[model samples]
Target: MKKIFCFLLILSLSAFGFYPSVSSASEKSQQEVKEAKQYVQKHVPILKNEFKKLSRSSSLEDIESLIEKHFKEYPAPQSLKSNKISVFDAFPEKQHKYEKFSGKSLNLNNLLNDIKTSSTGDVFTFESKDNTVKVLLGEFGDINILEQKSISNPSVSKAKTTKATGIQRQTGIGYGTYGTKLYTLWCEGNFSYNGKTVKVISKDGDYHKHPSGSILTLDPRGLGKERDASIGKYKYKEVFSRLRVEGVLGFKWGEWIYKARTVETYIGSTVDGNIYGGLKSYK
Candidate 1:
């Protein structure tokens, strides 16, 4: 009877012993899981709301408001020990502002037509003929090209500036929504007019060097045999006396980019030595 009582007491103690410890452990585990779920439930809405706001905002203000709202509701997780959000979190509006000038906004074809009919075309001649043998800028879009007949133009202008100066000479054209970084369009072709020959020059891509002095890269569609060849090379050249046109263009500035749409042509050069090439209508 004593042995049986001792055995029964041991069995009862063992069962109860596990019951208290396991119940306590299970309660703590459940609490932890509940807290985690609560944290996720709170923060998920914040992230979702911000993402939606970002998608709709054309300007940066809306995005910023959403970010501030999120922070108020979902403080950083405490388990992280140290919580720091990125500067982007501090100024979410800046994202849109930063992206404002990051892509092309003008229709190349339309802008070309706007410029061609807008001017008499001769107004694009380089004023600094003493330093630049030839400079031609489109008065329609951010497009320009300069050729140093002998590479000895006092201080040879940087390629982008040379191009811009030419564009600036145009009366009605201005930089499109892309803002000023760097835009280029160049081309070369052969044409015969009235028995004399002329080399037509044009450009059609963004060729601006970065602040770090790097040129922009090309996408698959932007890349062509024309881009791979040198603008200075004679291949794109055309010897047309009456008026023939050809050239390539490249553009780049910060995150903005553009390309020439209409092929370039030189007009009114029956005299042969006079240079004439400018952006024209697509049709």
Candidate 2:
């Protein structure tokens, strides 16, 4: 009797379309999937595209050009923009099986030396110029080029100021909801600190976003001025030019953070929506 009752209950649920399904893909659905795959192929040309190999006969210019070409083709996400290439060994040193580029500076001269000499299986890592996406080239002399094409965006690249400066692109991330990119900008400008006007250059990514924010107690004092001043927004143009940043303020413990305080803006550069971190506070 109990089994009969259970069977009836299941039958009732099935009638309401609650049973498991193993439906075949419809013709339209199949076409949509094919189209999606094609779009994905278009989205990331770096991985599918084949790179020309370097040879002993390759010149310094030739090698540089080849690597630059590959970097150009591989699209980087925003976070990985404006960064230098970092070099490392492709594998553990087995009696110095590979000659790694361990030069300290990211200067172009060192890069050329590393590339001109590194043998097969050596690795060179660097962020792409535009998107700052990481490029890990295996076998530097005879290289294997690779870039990011994953679902997540490219990571933030640590790079010095490029000719291109400023921050912009304030838009809504979702329907009926506006989104703002919260971050710090480095600028050399005149600002008022504790009631005195001063000109200074604050570190990058410390342009506090608000007049009031989370506890400064956690943040080490003296990095920049702490304030209750209204930190403002960066216009779209500002992001592209006025704002000097390596990347966006990303996840902190899996949560999005948009905290700010009075920070620095370039002296004499009046930008909308920012509380400049004035001259470094010193004892």
The numbered model that scores best in TM-score is 1
Worst 10 residues of 2 by lDDT: 5-14
Show model 1 residue runs off by greater than 4 Å. 1-126, 130-178, 187-271, 281-283
Off by over 4 Å in 2: 1-109, 112-114, 120-136, 140-202, 205-283
Q: How accurate is candidate 2 locally (lDDT)?
A: 0.21
- What's the C-alpha lDDT at position 248 in model 1? 22
Write candidate 1's Cα lDDT for 165-195 as tens digits. Answer: 1111111111211112222333222222222
The 0-to-1 C-alpha lDDT of every candidate, in the order given, reads 0.24, 0.21
Estimated TM-score for each candidate: 0.23, 0.19
Q: CA shift at 185, candidate 1, in angstroms?
A: 2.1
The per-residue C-alpha lDDT of model 1 at residue 167 equals 16
Best by lDDT: 1
Candidate 2, 168-229: lDDT as tens digits: 11110000000111222322212222222212222222334321111121232222222223
